[model samples]
Target: MRAKIVFASMTGNDEDMAEILEEDLLDAGLDVDTSDVSFTDASDYLDSDLCVLVTYTYGEGAMTDELVDFYEQLKQLDLSGKYFAVMGSGDKTYKEHYCENVFDFEKAFLACGAKELIAPLTVENAPTDEDIDRIDQAAEELANKLNG
Candidate 1:
């Protein structure tokens, strides 16, 4: 299956999460590609069979600029039937609003007509191996759903 993974990161945490998921998905037999939000176009991502979004929230529930732009563009575009899964990186210490970036992406993807095969996974700052494993499971499910 072909898939695109897009991410918006701060403190290098989300980027690390994206890299791990990308590698795991490839090892699981998928045609996967990764790019940062600034270098990717959400409308273009709609062309992929499956799209995974990884981002982190910061500053009292503020979504990153890249994510905001992508979400705005994606919500306005006609995805029609793109399949999507979301993973968010955040610090639980941030209080009140954690993982807003992942939630934001999920809402936008649905608004643009993408279907979700699983709920968003929000990884706390410096996620554990179990967090990575969960992401692996999510990717596997995504591949199975698309390939089967």
Candidate 2:
């Protein structure tokens, strides 16, 4: 199996989550490709068995500028048989908007016909040990679905 992780990080929190998930997926024996959202094309995941997005919510629930294009493009793609997951970092103080970007991406992927492999993950600022364990568990679930 193969996985592609595309992420956007302003404070590096989202990037860290992406890295952690990547390591977990690699350990599960899947080939993984990861890149910053700005440099990656949403269509690039077409060849992969799994698609993942990790991003940080920007200013009160807005998508980060660098991720806007990718998100839009992703919504327009056809990922009918693909499996996807989304995760992100946000400040919980934002209350209603916390991790909103992650949810937005999840919706976009669903609109493109991709099946969700797991629930979207949202972390406050940075991930704690428990959060990391959740991320690891997500990877394990994805691997199981792909290899089942």
Candidate 3:
């Protein structure tokens, strides 16, 4: 299976989560490509079996500026039959807006016909060991769903 991970990080927390997922997915024997959302096109995931987005919710429940165009482009694609997942880091102090970008990405993927492979993950800030474990579990589940 092939997987693509596109992420945007401000304080590097989301980037760390992306790397953890990438490593775990690689260990699961899938071919994976990971990139910063600013450096790649959203359509690049069209050729992959799994598409993952890791991002940070900027001030007051907003998508990072870097992700806006990618998000728009993603919404225009036909991702039917592809599997997708969204994960991110956010400040819990934001209350209802915490990790809002993650859910936005999830909705965009769903609207574009991608199937959700797992529940969206939102970290309070920097990911802790427990958060890493959850990400690992998600990777394992994703691998099984694709490779089974």
Candidate 4:
């Protein structure tokens, strides 16, 4: 099976999460394509068995620049029945809706009829072992459900 791991980040926390997930996915013997959602074409999500989104929120209750463009530009793509998972990386100290990025991706994918296999997960600073465990487990489950 194939997977796409896409990310948008400012301080690189989100990117790190994407990379970790990519590594885990790769170790699992899946062919995975990964890129920054900003510079990469959003249309790539269409080809993926699973589109894994890792992004961070900036300012207050708003999307990052890459994420903003994704929703505005790529929202028109036909993603019906596609599977997606979102992971948000943010500082809890900010106090302004830490999971907003994950929620935005979740809502956007659902609006486009994409299937969400699991509710989103969030990590602060770096992902803890527990966070990685959750993501890796979910990813494996997604792979099984989609591939079999």
Q: In TM-score terms, which candidate is top?
A: 3
What lDDT does the true structure give each of the candidates?
0.82, 0.92, 0.94, 0.80
Residues 1-148, candidate 3: write the lDDT tens digits: 9999998988999999999999999999999999999999999999899999999998798665678899999999999999999999888888999999999999999999999999999899999999999999999999998998
What is the per-residue lDDT of model 1 for residues 68-117, given as tens digits with 9 covering 90 to 100? Answer: 78878888877667788999787777776788768877888888888898
Give the candidates in order of lDDT, highest first. 3, 2, 1, 4
Q: Write the per-residue lDDT of candidate 4 for residues 1-148, one digit (tens) a residue.
A: 7889888878888887888888878887789999988777778888887877888877566875667888776578778867888887877877877767778888888888888877787888677888888778876776677767
What is the alpha-carbon lDDT for the whole of candidate 3? 0.94
The global Cα lDDT (0 to 1) of model 4 is 0.80
Worst 10 residues of 4 by lDDT: 57-66
User: For every model shown, what is its TM-score relative to the native structure?
Assistant: 0.93, 0.97, 0.98, 0.90
Worst 10 residues of 1 by lDDT: 59-68
Question: Residue 109 of candidate 3: its Cα lDDT?
Answer: 97
Model 2's lDDT to the true fold? 0.92
58: Cα error in model 4, Å:
1.7
Poorly placed runs, candidate 4 (over 4 Å)? none
